[model samples]
Target chain A: MKIMPCPLNGPRNISEFVHGGEVRDMPNPTTCTDREWAEYVFYSDNQAGIVTEWWLHAASGYWFIAERHTVTDEIIRTYDPSEIFNQRVEFSDETTAKEVGA
Target chain B: MSATSPESLSKRSFVYRQLAGASFRDIAGGAMATGVAEGNNNRSQAEQSALLDLSVLPRTGFRGLTAAAHLQAAGLPIPARPNQASVTGSGELVLRLSQKEFWLLGALSDSGAGVDALNQRGLPAADCYSLYCQDSHAWLALTGAHLPATLAKVCGVDLREASFPLGSIAQTSVARVNVVIVHHQLAGVPCFSILCDSAAAEYLWESLLDAMGEFGGEVIGSNALL
Candidate 1:
């Protein structure tokens, strides 16, 4: 059985998973031109090398990113999206100073 | 008649008559053993296991970043992680399906309440999520020894006692039907509570019986389970 290691559910059959499309950054829709939006939706790299993509575990509905070699189809590693796309909240010096009643 | 909810659509299981209709009766021994290959009995045997229909129970589901806090407000403890189920003293089962999703099974309140209690307690935060009366799934409990062996025929995960001890849940496919299997002990007997989509309930039920036939399995009533 070809096993895909799920970050949460552990290794399971490949059949239990669904391949999400390639991971790409979303251009700011309000600022980008129409052509850029079209390209984002309609283009593909499909390169034959190590690439990052999204995968969903069918049973649990858990989604994670997998880095795999295109030619060998071997998964290099799998990780949760939060590892890379973590949304950080930085408190400015002004805000902190005001909170302390400066 | 007009379209009925999935819960009221099927009053009994497909094999209810075959199992003698809510009675403590057993199907013919080895009833499904003819087609399976021989020597399959050496691995395990199923006993005192019965399949009961629990579709009539009230079920409500909710999920969001604040779901745990909402449940705690309702006086139910928040399960720490995925696949963990906590049963309240009142016999309500809360299963944490994922980081943000949870399914509340059985009655949520002592008044035999439906979804109101869930919505009421989860308020203010209720705007953050919605409580759904999920009639889409069929529920059953399989209790006995060798549950792992029987489940192995359909699911790919290891369900043995050591690997999948008590209080763990598995959201996996069984007989090609998406289902949630919760490990629990009923009356001190090992039991696995399975919930699957109502559309494929009959097919999954039959498949489970076929898998257990080689081990001398029989179907009993809910009385034996509760």
Candidate 2:
């Protein structure tokens, strides 16, 4: 593994991370006043994710997200966890992990 | 998993009918004493490189017990009321008290000096509890590119620098046995070395080997060391 450290962040060690929570269910901001949307946007549920959840690669020295399967441990996906929870889950039927090498 | 070194039995100072394999030798003075000498890369002493030897000084809480002879024997960590240690890089740092009870903790390297200072008990030692260190050539070095992600499979113990930081030592169970795990750098890549009884080597090996399979990782013996 080639180790590179850029002040702006190419990448950092995984050790400096904390699995924050599952990004889900935020009430749209425009639908409500500031307070209601503020609470929904900041907090998320942490379900122990024995299967999967949002992992804050806090130690990444950068802000990124890691989507991993808890049981098989094959990383289901890695994205910006913070923003990922906000992105839509593209539920598709293109089964088998080998299909798309994301 | 590879062949386990025949469990080596010998006379030593700590009072406890304990099996000292390559893993516990550092504290048992069998292998642990020479730990610093065997693999001391001066530059990374504090930088926290891969696979570190850690020791915990226990507080006599809970029900702490050793074999018997090693109870107060010279040169053993003052018996901390505890059972085994365990963990990898990503899991919890824990110690077993009974079948289910466990405590999470960590510290620096093994303190043989402190153990050596235990005042010998004065009871006419009945079948004395002996401290036997294993001399088998079973040493461990962890190798991985995604160790943090890999470690997440077994434990919820945070591996990030902010939560665990550098030079972190943890005592926990991986696959149910006691282990001492430390976070280290492998060519700047975060890696971890978790040590437990060599008898449990096969079990750990299988788990790690299984974990690495996803990454096309292969296991190499002593000759193919990292």
Best model number under DockQ: 1
Task: Give per-residue CA lDDT, model 1, range B1-226, as digits (tens).
Answer: 5322222333433333334312221111111111122222221222355454555555677777777777777888678988889887766678998888888876312322533466556354353475453557777667678689889988888989898988889888787777889997655667788988877777887888888777666555444433
| CA lDDT scores, all candidates in order | 0.69, 0.39
RMSD (Cα, Å) of model 2: 18.5
Candidate 1 lDDT over residue span A1-102, tens digit each: 799999877888898899998888878555568799788898878999999999998888899999999999999999998888888555467656654783
Evaluate model 2: give its TM-score: 0.30
In candidate 2, stretches whose alpha carbon ends up further than 4 angstroms from where it belongs are A1-102, B1-139, B185-190, B222-226
Off by over 4 Å in 1: A87-102, B1-47, B107-122, B131-133
Listed models, DockQ each: 0.48, 0.01
Docking class of 2: incorrect
Best by TM-score: 1
* Least well predicted 10-residue stretch by lDDT in candidate 1 chain B: B26-35
